[model samples]
Target chain A: DQQVKQNSPSLSVQEGRISILNCDYTNSMFDYFLWYKKYPAEGPTFLISISSIKDKNEDGRFTVFLNKSAKHLSLHIVPSQPGDSAVYFCAALPRKTGNQFYFGTGTSLTVIP
Target chain B: DAGITQSPRHKVTETGTPVTLRCHQTENHRYMYWYRQDPGHGLRLIHYSYGVKDTDKGEVSDGYSVSRSKTEDFLLTLESATSSQTSVYFCAISESTTGNTIYFGEGSWLTVV
Candidate 1:
């Protein structure tokens, strides 16, 4: 069973626009969430993360928002650049599971230049 | 860079053959993970190790085994290569000090014919 789900398989956005990727999880025990960016033939890289205690976290052009009650999270990339075009994955870590993270199917984001 | 490396970055093996992919890390992180990436599946955990001589299975552990004999080395072995097992594998490392941030290696591509 997939504990995490990314409803959207793909999304396209014009350069310099805001790109929002959404993810939902069924497990309420998940207390930590993260976003990873992956390019073709490469491993997924850490992008941003949010603790259950915080509703939002931002770094530069990237922002992550978490809603614990809804078991949902979204990643927003403002002024999306061509270089940002890649597959984005959202992962969740349960409060008691030691270092075990469940990942969503992923959303392919295309930032058209 | 987190100083993680995967050996045999690309490999091709025949059915029933045994294959092992090695992950070496210099960070000495307490947590090490092996994940497989497939189309529409995103990333699925195969196994993980928390310390030397300690290991645990993940969501999709069938037909796969892992060992951690030393702090720097984690090995993932496929008992019998199957066509369905052909996919890209990634190794990740995380430490408690980092607070849920996991760093991934470049990735290893394996093909079972």
Candidate 2:
């Protein structure tokens, strides 16, 4: 069974708009969450992360919100640019598990110009 | 970006042939991982190593084996190539078992014909 899931396969938004991508996890043991952005030919790079103690973390145009009680998290991009178009993956770190991470299926975001 | 590099950025091998992919890191991180990316499956872990000569299987470890003789290198080997095994492989590194950032290599594209 898939412990983490990105139900939306794809999402599209116009420039200067807000884009929201969601992820859900079934495992309650997960306490740390992260978001990674990947381009066509390159590896994924770290975007932002949030620990269980915090409900939100923001970095420039990117913001990640976590809701532990709901077992969900979302990445929000304000004033989305065309360059932001790519596949976004959210990973979860299970507490006290040697830092082994579980990844979601991914959501392809297309920012239109 | 962490100092992670993957060898054989692209390769094509015949069926039943053995292939090995190498991941080298200069970060001296204690945790290393091997993951494969496919169309539907975002990124699935094949194996991971916590220390030299120590390893553990991930979600999809079938038909694959891994070894870590040194802190800087982790190897993933496909004993016999199969068409279903064609995918993009990635190597990742992390400094600690806590909420450390995971960095991925550019990736190695492998095709089994």
**Which structure among the candidates has the greatest TM-score?**
2
Worst lDDT window (10 residues) for model 2 chain B?
Answer: B93-102
Q: Quote the lDDT for A82 in model 2.
A: 99
lDDT string for model 1 (B1-113, tens) is 78999998999999999999999999989999999999899899999998999999998999999999999999999999999999999999998732479899999999999
Clashes of 1: 0
Poorest stretch of ten by lDDT in candidate 1 chain A: A93-102
| Local distance difference test, each candidate | 0.94, 0.95
Candidate 1 chain B least-lDDT 10 residues: B94-103
lDDT of 1 at A27: 94
Best by DockQ: 2
What shift in Å separates residue B103 of candidate 2 from its native position after superposition?
0.4
Local accuracy of candidate 2 as per-residue lDDT tens digits, B1-113:
68999999999999999999999999999999999999878999999999999999999999999999999999999999999999999999998878889999999999999
lDDT: which candidate is best? 2
